[model samples]
Target: MNKVLCFDLDGTLINDKNEIIGGEGTIHALKKLQNIGYKLVVSTGRLEHDIYYINNRYDLKLNYAISQNGAVINKNKELNAKLLDKDEALNIYEYLKTTDLRVELNTVSNRYWHTDRDPDFPKEYYDSSNIVHDFRNVIEYQPAVLFLVIGESDKIKVVQEHINSNYNKVKAIRTSDSSLEILSEGISKGNTVVELFPNSEIISIGDSENDFSMFELSKKSYYVGKGSCNKATYNFSSIYEALKQIIKGEENGQ
Candidate 1:
């Protein structure tokens, strides 16, 4: 039986800065582990486009990806997507609209924002070429697989509290301290991993509170030392060092 290694993109595999500044060794180490039959997958709150940006920029080849915090699962190809049902998605959307909050909808291939900003909105955080749409009328369409709301910490908390209080139909996850993300209930990184590799032993690596679900489901969990979260099996100073250790262990049949 083969072992599965799932990595969280932003902090565990790369870093908060998103430069891949010190993960080359880690990538190489994972690749070496893959060569020895350890399956490597990425589970992240980001969308496919975001993952593709990192892959293309760094010239990486991943086996599978669980995106939108687990609302989507795929194997690199856009055509191989598994998304939430339209009715379930719409229900969450309708409930969210009743609050004093803005939402961003994400499909398997595109992301739509309910703002006046152009579809080609600029992202100051990372170098991304993600397709953005000005979905002024979101209700016109069914709910998307992923929905995001960004604002101040207090506002986001209020919104989260409201959602938790009023809506029990969706899973609301806060990937970042300032952002709230909603998805279909029971849909998460752990669920996706089980769906794809039911029999494989699972290990997860991540660095945020949003990764709690994955950590809870994993047999072993690792966290990047500098990330926001504190629960982990091991804390590493850098991705490179972590990968080297993982690769060496896997290579030695440990």
Candidate 2:
């Protein structure tokens, strides 16, 4: 099997509005990468429903996707083949309720959230997720990822400390100054790629702090936009530009 070129969905593959800015040529870039013996993998924090929804709407034609920040992996056209344990998810959910943060809990089939007292939440979130009215059934639902949005850096540290002290089998990473993502230990988009393709040369592409893990693990990395990520081999303004650079290198017999 060929090595993979992993892509982060939002900001890397498309805009916040779920649009790829370069138009149809971007699709051609993906196909060209495939023609050049690379398998394209869409890696994102989105649920399966939203990933499929965006791909169909945008015609991205994704073959593989690592969803929920790598809490789940879909390969060979199968969906959600790997998932986190439900009891561990309940542990996260129950403890987070005591803290002052908004949480988005995800499973393969559904998404539940708690946005209490969070007035700054985007309107799209209001329409996208189900409010967690009943948590009695959370464990039975088998969550794949737990995303918490904290208002301050202190709260982010608090959660990080809590995970370190109590749930050493899980991990808490700061996706942003105000956002923390929780998942099983070693469950990251980069780790997933390493686990699935242990000997492959992986090229990871992303644009944010959430993407740092992949950059660290990739054979080479193309970071989109200007930000700090450990071990990014190159930087590009957009996916189209990155693809063109790689294709051009191939044409020169590099």
lDDT (Cα atoms) of all candidates against the true structure: 0.68, 0.73
Model 2: lDDT of residue 217: 86
**Candidate 1: clashing residue pairs, number:** 0
Candidate 1 C-alpha lDDT tens digits along 163-190? 6676667767777766788766778787
Q: lDDT tens string, model 2, 95-138?
A: 88888776676656566665443554422322446677755486
Residue 199, candidate 1: Cα error in Å is 0.9
Ten contiguous residues minimizing lDDT sum, candidate 2: 119-128
User: Positional deviation of 123 in candidate 1, in angstroms?
Assistant: 3.7
lDDT at position 147, candidate 2? 51
* RMSD of model 2 against the true structure: 3.0
**Each model's RMSD to truth, in Å?**
4.0, 3.0
Model 2 bad stretches (over 4 Å): 80-87, 115-128, 141-144
State the TM-score for model 1. 0.80
